[model samples]
Target: MIVAEHLTKRFGQKQAVSDVSFTVAPGKVTGFLGPNGAGKSTTMRMIVGLDRPTSGSVSIDGRSYSSLRSPLTEVGVLLDAKAVHTGRSAVNHLRSMAATHGIRRSRVDEVIEITGLTSVARKRAGGFSLGMGQRLGIAAALLGDPHTLILDEPVNGLDPEGVMWVRRFVRHAASEGRAVLLSSHLMSEMALTADHLIILGRGRVLADAPLADIVEQWTTKSVRVRSPRAREIAEAAASDTVSVTSRGNGYLDINGATAAEIGELAAARSLPLHELTPTTGTLEDAYLKLTGDQVEYKTKEVR
Candidate 1:
């Protein structure tokens, strides 16, 4: 498990992260999400000892990252896919990383095939494409079979197949009781992959909870009603607590209520209803609403 308490970072006069605290538990995938300039990269950097925090502390398991005797075996990190030597072959690079941790060559070969790097094993790192480089980086991370994994944008340049493979791989790893933390800009993918979420805004944690809880708490549930007496329904339902709006001719949108309530309201008035569909909020909806006021750069509307 990874635990961070009162984590804060400052660069001269600017504060990048402030009193941020969160936990990435074992046997689960925790997704890190935030808008641009929300200090996600800085937080990840601090976790692996890349950037020293101005105050507070973070630990993997029970010790700091620098205190670990064998850091690679305890936690595998892929913060930058391009950190490898450009002149080295993919196979040689993995071998070199393995040499530091006393890992065997068979393990190196195993990760190569696991990450689908056999075709480019002998190819120089500089010649690999963006997707291939990502695969190679993943191979190095998996070389030691670490108990914890931290990947930033692992599927950034992957194709559909590669993306699916990564999704399944992370799920399988978490099932084996490893702590996994990843950050991505793809909400649709994150919704399908992550079991929990840690959302950041303005260098502070806005939410940290299960994916379902985040969606339920941050979004509004609504019912769509269609009938000849739509206007009548709207007039009856309109109040300080409930909201009703007419969508053109025969449709009424109802909020702050349930389908059963709307149906009972229509039945009491002897109104014939054609449709009554309830829509639950999704992860994307919750994210947009939660971070709506926290965006730093707002786009101007084109007239």
Candidate 2:
């Protein structure tokens, strides 16, 4: 398990992270989500002792990362996939990291095969594609067989297959009772990969809850209804309990009501209902609603 208590970080006059706290437990993939410049990288850096926190503390299994007897064997971090020296081969890079803790060379080879980098393990990292770099980074992280994995944008440059590989890997790791903290800005990806979500905006916690709970709390549940007498149904259900929006061609999207409710209303009115289906808001909708004002950049459309 990983615990971050009142974590904060500052760069000169600007505060990168502010009093952030969250727990990444074992047996589940906890998604660390935020917008651009929302301090996720800084927070992850502090967790691994790469950047000293201005205040508060972060611990892996009750001990600070720096204080761990075998840091690499306890917590494997892949904060930057491109931080390696380009001159070195992927095998050499893992070998060097393994040397720090006396991790066996066999473990390095094992990780190479596991990450599917054995085909190009001897090639210079500089010539590798972005996907290959990501694989190398993952291999390095798994070299020690650590119980906790901290991955930041692990699928950034990966193809569809690579993305699926990462999703399955994270799920498998968490199922084995390993603490997995995955940081990413992609809500769609997080929706598929994370069981729980930690949303951050403006360097503070916006929401930390199960994915279902977050969706339920911040999103509206609604239903789509289609009827030949759409106008008649809208007029009949124009009450505060229901909101109706026309969807063109005798269709409407109704909120604050369910499919059953709409069906009953149509039946009572003898309305010719063609379709009625339930619809729930997605994680992207919830995230946009939560961070609408906190977004750093907004694009303006040309008329």
TM-score per prediction, in order, is: 0.93, 0.96
* Model 1 per-residue lDDT tens digits across residues 1-303: 999999999999999999999999999999999998788999999999999999999999979999999988889899889999999999999999999999999999999999999998999999999999999888887888999999999998999999999999999999999999989989999999999999999899999999999999998999999998788888887889899888888988899888999889889998889999998888999999989998876899899
Per-residue lDDT for 1-303 in model 2, tens only?
999999989899988889999999999999998888888889999998899999999989999988999988999899989999999999999999999999999999999998889899999999999999999999988988999999999998999998999999999999999999998877888999999999888899999999999999999998888888999988887788888999999999988887888899899988888899899999999999998888776678799
Candidate 2 accuracy as lDDT:
0.91
lDDT of each: 0.93, 0.91
Clashes found in each candidate (C-alpha, N, C closer than 3 A): 0, 0
Model 2 spans > 4 angstroms off: 301-303
Worst 10 residues of 2 by lDDT: 292-301
TM-score winner among the candidates?
2
Any runs in candidate 1 off by more than 4 Å, and if so which? none
Clashing pairs in 2: none
